[model samples]
Target: MRKIMTNKTSKYILLLICSMSLLSCEKFLDKQPNDMLNLDQVFSIRLETERYLANVYSYIPDPLVCNGVNYTPLSDEADWVFNWPHQQINTGNWSPVNTPYDIWSKYYKGIRAASTFINRVSECKECDELNPGITVQYREEARVLRAFYYFLLIRQYGPVTILPDVPLAIDAPLSEMQLPRNSYDECVDFIVSELDKAQQVLPDKQSNTREYGRTSAGMARALKARVLLYAASPLWNGNTDYADFKNKDGKQLVNQVYDQNKWRKAAEAAKSVIDKMPEGLYKKNGTDGKFDPFLSYQYVFLDRWNTEVIWARPMTGDAVRWERCSAPRQINGYIGLGPSQQLVDEYEMENGMSPFTAASTTANPVINPASGYTETGFSTTATKFTKAGIHNMYVGREPRFYATVGFNGMDWVYKGADGKTIIRVELFSTGKDGYNGSNDHSTTGYTTVKYVHPESDVRNGRHVLKSWIFFRLAEFYLNYAEALNEYDPQNPDIYKYINLIRERGGIPSLPEGLNQDQIRERIRHERRIELALEEHRFWDVKRWKIAEQTDAAPIYGMNVTTGTSFSDQNFYKRKITESRTFQKKHFLWPVPQYEIERNTELVQNPEW
Candidate 1:
């Protein structure tokens, strides 16, 4: 975002205030010249209008900022100090009155900004005069963004009223403005239609350096891929629980019957993103003429506007907070964000096989025991690949696992005053990052080494920050693969897309003989591993309607106890860190109680 997307320093908002100056012939008052820039001034200039759109772009949530159990903790993906708000949500203790992640107002404001920009931009004489055809693109961008905001609103709240071009005037009668919510299907249709229109107008790429983070045709398609994916999923796909729910007009809020075509539509949308776009998995070529998965996956977030990135948001100064909060305690970082043993177990072996039944502790079992994968103790010999001794639990795993998790006795690549040095990780109970006091210790005895740039100096407070990707080429492939598996399981394209992600991740692709159900779980597993903690698992598990099973599973961690030998005191015991609760009602978040109170026309989601 720093490259060209300017952050309007103090222009925090656009307030609506109307005043009429009629029949004031005799009045002589000091008006102070009213330096306040109005809609006329804003739309008149191209840059100012862009600034308004940039404000809407700001509404796009940064996936890196994890507030008090908000992200990794909210899902079974990871655990931290267990913030109360996250605990409440995970344990099903939250409600409409005390909502945890309410974005209704925030997104609506973005929708409003987009609506206002799209409505008034064409009327600006100077804008068209100066920018020529660019205004059309700007308008389309705003329209697509408005659609995205609506998508955000509906994803959590189930369905939201699709606001029109001009929000009803403030002075209007309540009946005129307090509109009822649209059905889920209507919202989906509107989002899809808006994106289609946006795609026709948006450029394939924002060619100018000034428009690096700006929306493009690819983003519109990428968003459509996600939107349609949700629409095709079970949560929104003909769930009879909401059969009785309807709007004031008696139109059903949830669609009544399952549409098999929805999956085909989703697959096509995702396939378009892959087949038509220039984007693909971010690959760093090795000297040996191969793609390095660890470096590729790590740098996908580290590299700015890299090849695979479909949409990205700059972290700005907020990255340092994430670095400090997520850094391991040994490095004077909180080690606050720790990947769960559950997440750890989910990563397959390098041979592309699950370790679900491995010879490990029942609490935190490893999969694929045939690979000799073990949590037995520290490695007897240094791995030739890393040239540092890694624990057996940390060994024989895929490159992504090595790239993502920082386990006990694993080599830590840190940039010091001299240069890049490799040191073993010590996460024993009394070890540097072990569980002694929870202040900065890792609750799971594992650190999220995924985004920690090798050069970040935790003790010195230096950070290695880069653009956070909202969508990537790998996801498009995954999305298509998942949907295709659901619809056309026999389609060779299903295995093709899934294998693309697997090949990029250094895992062997599916050979053959795998059925639809097996492919479905594999697609989900790949998503869980590939897109870990990018804020997808929290929603994906819920959207798949498997959160009750997945989220309810107890969050697990390592209870490291250092003793005499490798298997003695250093033996890492699995511990149940915390028990979680998930219900069918928890699938969709309740609308804010205040929103229901404010608008009598608004209907709450079922059970709320």
Candidate 2:
């Protein structure tokens, strides 16, 4: 861990203290001088201490934002029409010095802040007197948050330097501050142990609406499950590629021997969450009082504090900006974010059969005759979900497909000039939201509808308020199923959990008697569909050691440049939208070059 020297410690602390004061004017008692006295004053008052904790919570990244931190454009799931820094990664134009989506320093700073709060919050003189056990709960929240930040760091950088629970003093000797990166297993153990400690004191759920986004036992357990799952994956577990990768003292950073027991540990971790937490797969009932899969899937995100969410931040950040980028041009939006053809083909038909028996390099996919999917024509009649003359390829698909993908002719349910009208989106060459050789259009002739609210009128400043879910119950189910299949393939619990997600996704349950390999593919595909655009696919492929096949491949989409009209067959043809480059080194992000320069003990990742 790179330590802040004496000269810079005061500046960093002052900045954080000032930011906390800005969060709420009434909470801060007074402005103080920048010194040790001011630092002590912050922890002396109850409101000031709570405000400092809030500052620690502010570092949680907004995955919904289409910035460097966002992973959707970095993966094959989607593309950004404009030139964002995250796109630099797809073209192999980034490095340690020019790293895009770099959160190494950001999260380390968060970890430091959390440690500081954890160590200092006990000094609050008024907290215990005013509210018994409040300071203890606050300290536990900071502990879980610190563990979570470490989890985020390891997921991207792989085996980062773990700081001690007690933050180093600003005036610590330079030699004492420089630290080498911890081993992968050591880091995982430290994070899990911290989460376990926090979970012992935190509540399973926050009953008060005011504490909505605060850390809970459920969040700690969910994060622990995800961390264990990643540690058990091929990237970290017995990966021989890092055999020679070592620290300054010749300590192997990644383990070099396979451990089947790791998978068992991961399965047990996920099962703990399922058995202990009261969360379930969120559902919404239709007009007939049955489980409406489409609404159930769509509103899981739109609905506030639903049972599905294990952890979520309060409705903060500019969610309206994301809605604007995803909306069609007819509703006065940018329409720059488009789903790829590869993702579109991943959705199953109504009967739960995949549309493609095999993927193709050409415009045509190897269609599965049993699935009844076609690319050559339009629908002649209206179906229950789609309208007449819509592309045949988009029709008769699963409920999640309609809930997620905004096709060329899909209706935009928005308020009209008279306050009510369904505007049809036109993504043909000459249509409203089509690729008109502009930066604001959808390059793939499609837009993402998963996170965009149907009634959000970006033109009129009407935005819906909803939490950006960080962890959910569906993820643990898939995690349990995947881990169980690796260690105990014959376990009936595997199919039971997978079926729960499939049922909510409006698809049929898996056929019995699937072998281990078959079940692996099903679990991966389910994750891709269920957790789409929630910042999971990017890390998932890498952890599974399959990014070379998925991320390195050419990104495909509909032919947005050649179509003449809304119903043109040429527009429905698959075309290469972007080409990506992914090498073995791309699996883990490079340690930032500046960090390497600052700490001689710190080593760079494999090739960077």
Candidate 3:
């Protein structure tokens, strides 16, 4: 299956190249009706039809790369050291006209391509003859892909223009192309209905590795669950902020009324996926039959197509670049990606007690004495996870903390000049990976180890190649717990699923008899830790309508500029690294100014 997809991908690339060459030649040659003729030729051939379907699959965003679809750096979870377009977002330097990380045009282009494929795939009689039901599956794939693109568009831009299933022709009138934005609920309903139609025809899972990244019934259901979950969130549900936001015809782009049943719908949607898949959370057990939480949590991203993964891109984009940017300077890496102190503080102690009782911005963090967490002093003794003399701030934390964070003195498993050796990361000013007035250093005084394989040796140019998972089983568990807690806090299923993740992270389960608010906070915290750096934090905060408190707040890290050595206590002191901005308008990114200019009928988001 992998070989077949690879061949198809190559053919698609060749097709694109030929298309581009023909486009250039069209400038010199007489204009004819060749566009339709070429498209007709493409759909009439079996292999060419398959290649076109592969091209539609190519638009699935690359989550591994920070500059593209991944929104990690735009949130409080992590920071990218170099100046990328996403970095400007935190500073409130972007606007509708000057939008950074603008995926509006890119996704709409994909939608048009998918729509065209869906409408024309049946024309390929040769495709059905080659593989009896292949064309039917191909049409379903294209349908779901179109729905997925709409999902992405709404996720980023809130309300968007929902194009018809049949794409507009090249000769379509300009006035006909200018369409108004659909109401938020209408858009959601359309996407959900389309997904349902595709889900009925698509198989539960891809039969072969060749179709690994392609859409399946599971992907459609999982995507539906996410879309419904977002629709149920506070930002979209009863969000009065968008009350005045309407189109030229006074059609409400955002629903003004709140609905509690949306949460139930979200829960049911998530449960549907849970009840269907036999796959569980990916775990690594020791030979003694004991679950190794550290390895289990670490390897979930490193291992390709693990039991936890539901959907992943077959071709990983710039994954090695992600590792190179994450690796320390001592090992010939850029060392730019840094985790925030707020995320570090969110991790529970070995006993499952949160370290900070208050928010991260409190002058003196009210530490949890029962959790045995201390910000000052160094550990005199080594535990199973850390070395002796490591800062108390990093010692005796959860297994996930060890797996995700690269604190000062943490052992980084790497292949050295001779062979594999353990290199302790030095993140002080004078240390190897420390902030040395270069842009390639970690601004937060710490680096990230998540999604970075242990054997990845940047210095030797050897890196691991793995799919960037878009949807996973663990996310559904978190989603289920969150939605259930909102409308059915008393339901025991909430604790059951949340505890499943906690147990996998080597932490104790939640104590019984917690209130609705308490359970909600715990569930949100679980998502923060469990799905860290997986591109959920950014949207999670937005949908929950808490970005003003989290994203706009001052983000902190260790004093990277003042540290003299690895053991310098001044280096360990917490300090603000970046101050961000999040206005009410930030809940949904503004429709690109160019888009608004092109279509006067389109309405910009509120306060853009």
Candidate 4:
């Protein structure tokens, strides 16, 4: 839960830049501001140009909204871990006002900045501006940044404008600025065009280590693939959820039938990135000779230079710390988000079959082998369960879960008040430290342990200062598998891409001769499990129009009580909500209600 901001002085300067436009003539569309020197004066300084580029990264999650705290309703779906109050809400109501809105706003702010910078810099008469090589690179960087923002908007809103240039007015009237939403197809074309422009000027990711988190040719290609995949999804292509577009004034923008070939284009884009990217998975610490292709996923998020991350947003200053924020409330803080049983079940068993779908296996029976529960623990357990559903549910599921979630009765280690490393018992049973039952000091029941530093490095702000990964190499592989399976029936390589992920997760490979639909289903399952709680699921559901399939079910949360030990109880068996969905009007967020009122040219999305 870190917030990365541009330096205060630079932000003030940007405010000045925006403010100066106000004092000048209203018709000064391309005019330079008076307080700041002409573009030539600013562009002459090397640091000034770089500083403007750096401002694009200034937008990131506010600490309060990061993984540490779960106020957003989307967290209830899959992209985040939620506990307590969050666990009890109707996740379907995740509206424009949710965390998605905040993320959208910040991304657009960057897009606006980049667009302005690109326009101004291209016109500058300075030597830096005259240098076509660097200028082209800078221009592509701005386009790539703008493409990223468009992708975010499209993924969340379905159909959005592709504003290649900054709007002339900060508060332009809707009538004066009236622009219809582009067709999703047109949006995809615009994004791909921007990426194509970016690839020409962007350096290969391997060219520079210092700028490791910067967007690269690989990032641009990978993102284009992702945009196409969403457009080609069953929800968008075959589903009826996003067949129409509406604006704030109840106006239709553009509409077109979704096509399956978008998947083919998506697959091709993914292939382009895979063939070029120089990054690989970050490995885990292991003892035996078995090479775990899968390492601790936390490494990608917590390790800045982690090879898998293609583009990232680094966290520094006070934002570097995530321990107290992500730790449990019982550890003397707010109770962090808890992983729901929904996600816990999504990860396939070691054998690669959902426990719900698996044929009764004698080794891992539905009933607990021990004398804790009374009925078959699989299907029957959900209805009349006591202790944790199936021991195997916790047993050998995946290594990532252990690294990500702190489970019942695990040792919580940290430097105690004596400045010495102390291991405290976190679950119900008492061993070395007496079990603390209070949520205030310890709902640290399943406190998140992923981002915390090792005991030896337990200084107040000693957490890893890694960049927040926006996209990783593995995701590109998954995107390829997903798109190919959907678009190309003749290709057998689809299974190969998916199996790579399955092999890493310790899940079994797919049975031979499965149809494309079967393979597609498997890929979706893999993505949900592999990318759990990383801000992907909510968009996945929205784009796939499976918000109904994925979101229709009421969210459930484990019912843990204070002072009562759930060691012998199925503490997680509790019904929270009934169902969730986007109302026809809720599909695209109403261009925030205030914005519509402020800018007459700006139309709101259908129903507010």
lDDT of 2 at 196: 92
lDDT scores in order: 0.74, 0.83, 0.82, 0.55
lDDT of 3 at 527: 97
Candidate 1: regions farther than 4 A off: 1-35, 68-70, 82-84, 287-289, 358-367, 384-389, 421-423, 560-571
Q: What is candidate 4's lDDT per residue for 134-165, written digit by digit as tens?
A: 55566676778778878877765666666647
For each candidate, what TM-score against the reference? 0.90, 0.93, 0.93, 0.77
In candidate 2 the C-alpha lDDT for residue 188 amounts to 100
List the candidate numbers ranked by TM-score, top first: 2, 3, 1, 4
Q: State candidate 2's TM-score.
A: 0.93
Candidate 1 lDDT over 38-61, as tens digits, reads 878877765566556555565666
The CA lDDT at 383 in model 3 is 90
Which stretch of 10 consecutive residues in model 2 shows the poorest summed lDDT? 1-10
lDDT head-to-head 3 vs 4, winner? 3
Candidate 2 residues 1-608, lDDT tens each? 11112332222233223322233222432433224546589899765676677678778877666543678898888887878887788999998999888899999998998899899888986866665566788788889989999998999889989897788888999897889999999999999999999888888876654446778898999999999999999999999999988998999999999999999999999999998755578999999999899999999989978888888865433556688788887778888888888788889998999988855433567888989998878899999789998989999999999888898888888655566668888888888777773568887778888877776677776767676789899999999999999999999999999999999988999999889999999999999899988889998999999999889988888888877777788888778899889999999899999999999999999988
Q: How many clashing residue pairs, candidate 2?
A: 0
Off by over 4 Å in 2: 1-37, 358-364, 416-418
Cα error of candidate 4 at position 70, Å: 7.8
Give the number of the best model, judged by lDDT: 2
Superposition TM-score, candidate 1 onto the true structure: 0.90
